[model samples]
Target: MSNHEVRMSEWVDRVLPSPTAALESTVAKLQREGQTVHRLGLGQPDFPTPDRAKQAAIQAIEDNFTGYTDTGGILSLRQAVCDSLRKEMNLSYEPDQIVVSAGGKQALFNAICTLCREGDEVLIPIPYWVSFPEQVKFAGGKPIFVPTLPEQGYKTTPETLAPYVNESTRILILNHPNNPSGAVYSTRELLELAAFCQRNNLWVISDEVYSTFVFTPEKFTSIAAFPGMKERTVVINAVSKSYSMTGWRIGYAAAPQAVAQAMLRLQSHTTSNPSSIAQKAALAAIVGPQNEMEPIHNEYLARRDYFVEAVRGLQGLECLVPDGAFYVWVDASYWCGRKLLGRMIHSSDDLAAALLQEAGVAVMPGTGFGSPTHLRLSFAVSRSELESGIAAMEAILGLK
Candidate 1:
């Protein structure tokens, strides 16, 4: 290797490019070969941004709002965030405590950097979002994974988390309406967990980006809104899922003033500020015709219902009905450590590879989400895609 062919820093090298994004490239290549692909690899929404939000961005450009704004985001957008929190969650947060970031991804990273240090252990639930552990590792912190099985509705409980808690434990990353596993904790569940965090003096980073996708009769509850939790909790959310504005790059975190300041300090040098136009769009999203969410929510609910029924009917594949979010997590443990169709299947990754190559269906492997022998099929794709993907997966597994 030449001197210029140097290695990336340990931190950067430790993280894999987002698994979903990596698979997108493969899907593109396969499609270019004139092959059909059913994409469930990424959790990105397929809906367009609300017209009101798009119009706001267009107006911002016309109004010459292209220049960089404050590093913490424009005051109006932050205030909108605060107002939304009050209206929806009945929680109060000063705009000063909010830092609008490029996406929920960046918001979470900022919070992690602010609270975690070398040797600090952050408790993360199994079947978590792919980025949580990697972000903690990048920040020089250790991640202690707490298992949450399907029987528990794939949620972290005080009892399940207790054993992982030790003197070194400093934070807990909770993503309700969880990414792959669409587990939504009940208020009672959160109350108990909040008590546990209080007992341990631990900080909580609550990823509520999918808060609006909930389909359960049990209401979505934020841990940050509970008694005695606001000071120690960082609530992370975005307009990506709710408003179908993934490309807008607007997510925010509401935290204690000190922690918010630390995040702002770090972000000021890094991203400087989220896009000014995006902020205007976000402000419009927050205050726009929220009725647009009804149709989007209904579509996700319909898709979720259809996908769950289809998956459970397939032989050797078991699915848990997700209460929220657009992902349907299925147990693929039947294929683990087994041989099928001339391939040695040992892990979720191997199975996912086989399916992608053999079936032309792209699904995310559970290994990326801290689970083995499992797969996460995103229902965010079109119904036709879902029908085709399910049939392909069912046939590959020898199901009628």
Candidate 2:
């Protein structure tokens, strides 16, 4: 090994590998060895990119629009983003205030880097997206976790987050239509939280990546829509989930001009700009008619209902029906600290491993998201795959 590799910074050394990626690799290896693995660990949509978006990319390539665009994104793409936000969410934003990136992941990292400094503290609700805490650490900020339990539907209230705020609290990250929990905050709840942030002079990073996947009657409201919040809120969203264009790698953030400029600077130094073809595809996605996207949302809703019902059949496992995202965060603590197949199952990690190795099913351990006793099961796969995975897990737990 080279001596240069041994002299890496402590931050790089202490950073742990993403549990989601680790589980994905394990499943890939299992499949390589000819083991049939039903993967419910990663939350990727199993749908192809929309035909219109694919056509747009093809046209862009044919038109020779392959060169690098502006770091903040091409003007047409930003305008499309603004128009989509207005038409769909009734939220108003200017194209100049948007910063398009490789994906919603990069948009979030840019927000963290631009807003937080060393020793600054960011308030994140527990059972968060696995990337949040790690992103904060990468930005040289401390992540203060506020636990949100299954009883509360895994949604944190203003009360729950209040105590975590202090003089050093610079940002609060909220992933509504949340990743693992699928918790979508109500308008009233969001208003209350927005008021608190406005009073504290704290920045709000509202991640609405799953905004369009909401299944409830209550409408999804953006924090940026709250009065006085536009100046302080960085709204991150993408066409990845809404248009089933995950592989296109397109996402953007809408924020105040100053914040947007800061992110642009950071992005210029790092990624420069998102893929030109992907940006064109995203433009097509945002500008296209909405009826084409309905079937995807309906499919996810059916899968959510099916998985929640199946989980309910398991005696010890409890899951809340998520309103937006295609995940069922189940409390599998009943099996924690118990013996399973002659090995001590002490945490969700152990359960996940046993499920993959012993049952040929893959699920994400909640400890990666700061909830050690829970497990996240993605219903994004086919109904048959979901059924098989759940049945295998039930047999492993002796529930069937």
Candidate 3:
């Protein structure tokens, strides 16, 4: 290194921090100045870690279980994840097929970096998790996007995806009970996609972190569960969303043995292993809880039911009826070119800024998620927060 060397932006430097994190920081700044803030920027579920899980971590510390385990993870915890997947989703994975990482984000990164290379193109559905394309870009792979239709619940069909596939296509990233837009693919629909992938020899990376939170009649279908599909799919999951243990930083991917081994090698050099105490907590969360899911699901479903109806009932606002996960995708395209919130608004970003500035409500703009006409609002907070945020929105936008 030399003093003459200047900082530069390569693909490594191309990634931007999430707009959600930026909005959250702004909201914190405003609140520090004594403004009333209704926080709705992050997809954080407001539930405490289960009693048994918390106690397990405490007990782990008391018992001096702080030493590192296998870089892949403790054998027992990996086995626990395998058992849970088999029992709940009927998806089977041997211990060798799993690579535990810091979080689902890292798991996806490890998987992508392992599988994709220069000139490879991965198919990403639009309104994706903000990090998907960035991860692909960092891996030296091109991201070919296929847009999901709004009227179709934001789920892509094989017909819509056919145009995006080519000889360079290598992987198709699927996020069920999706981030930003809560669309869950049906098993039959996934089977069709599976057939298409099989014909094209395209590998699948399924992010099922929100696997447990389907609302109403929507069912969760892991793409790997499709017949003969496990060999081509890397199933990524975490306890952060379902078990409300975001800070635990534990996530794992179940892939074909070769793919798992590659990610395992990557993890060895980079993260080495996730936190041991977090693994203990995650194991407890995995094998201990049988009750909390239902109540939390009920609360989220109710919030979705009320929030969608309220959002759609408003004269100018439009929102999709979310099938799973805890977000409502509000279409703010109509507000373009209108003057409100002390400025001329032209896109979702403007509307988001306006809402936060005028109404003291922090909602995420959809630009980072690849949709400039929408906003992603999370209902993962308490019911009261939802009400307050919605009230602020209505008052400012005159939605009433």
Candidate 1, 206: how far from true, in Å? 0.3
Predicted model with the maximum lDDT: 1
lDDT of 1 by residue, 302-339 (tens): 98889889988876779889998899898989889888
How many angstroms is residue 96 displaced in model 1 relative to the true structure, after the best TM-score fit?
0.7
The better-scoring model by lDDT among 2 and 3 is: 2
Taken over the whole model, the C-alpha lDDT of each candidate is 0.91, 0.89, 0.88
Write down the lDDT that model 2 would get. 0.89
Off by over 4 Å in 2: 2-5
Q: Candidates 1 and 2: which is better by lDDT?
A: 1
What's model 1's overall lDDT? 0.91
Could you give the C-alpha RMSD of every candidate to the true structure, in order shown? 1.5, 1.5, 2.0
lDDT minimum window of 10 residues, candidate 3 = 3-12
Relative to the unseen true structure, what is the C-alpha lDDT of residue 51 in candidate 2, on a scale of 0 to 100? 85
